[model samples]
Target: MKVLAARRRDAEDIRFLIDHLGLTNAEQVLALCGKVFPEEEMPGRARLVLGDIFDDS
Candidate 1:
């Protein structure tokens, strides 16, 4: 969880849109996650709550 937060912060610090892509909608966020972390192949339709992104929804 900490690692994820740290990497996200680093991406934001560098102003990398592709890395820290939490726009204002769930749909876009899901799509961005798919492109950013394709190897994980995260389910694009899963609900995204606050806190850990890997937490079971």
Candidate 2:
């Protein structure tokens, strides 16, 4: 439904930001995630996922 579609769009937007914006740390991910999915509490989760997806180390 509409909610699912919006989620898909948000996922795509997140991927685009990850690929293009050079996010270098979990803090950056937390900031962007807060803006992107403000309804959710996601800082810890965001840090975990960001480690999996983006590791400059």
Candidate 3:
């Protein structure tokens, strides 16, 4: 679905921002998401992706 693809794109964008901006902390990345995506939907999407990507390994 289009929404799923959009979420994936958002996740990739968040990953790019974190990596390219050298944000090594999940909290920091989330804060950036707060700025980049002030709307409720995208921030939530970013948070979900970030949670998975940054989870303890």
Candidate 1 per-residue C-alpha lDDT over 1-57 given as tens digits, one digit per residue, 9 for 90 to 100: 222243544433323332465454445655666676776644322343322333322
lDDT of 3: 0.58
Clashes of each: 0, 0, 0
Q: What lDDT does model 1 reach? A: 0.41
The full ranking of all candidates by lDDT, starting with the best, is 3, 2, 1
Query: What TM-score fits each model?
Result: 0.37, 0.47, 0.51
Candidate 2: tens digits of C-alpha lDDT, residues 6-31: 34335445555666778676577677
Q: Write the per-residue lDDT of candidate 3 for residues 1-41, one digit (tens) a residue.
A: 22223376565565665677887777786566557666634
Quantify all predictions' global Cα lDDT against the true fold. 0.41, 0.54, 0.58
Candidate 2: list runs displaced more than 4 Å.
1-17, 53-56
RMSD of each: 8.0, 6.1, 4.9
Give the residue spans of candidate 1 off by over 4 A.
Answer: 1-22, 43-57
Considering lDDT, which of the candidate structures 1 and 3 is the better prediction for this target?
3
Model 3 weakest 10-residue run by lDDT: 1-10
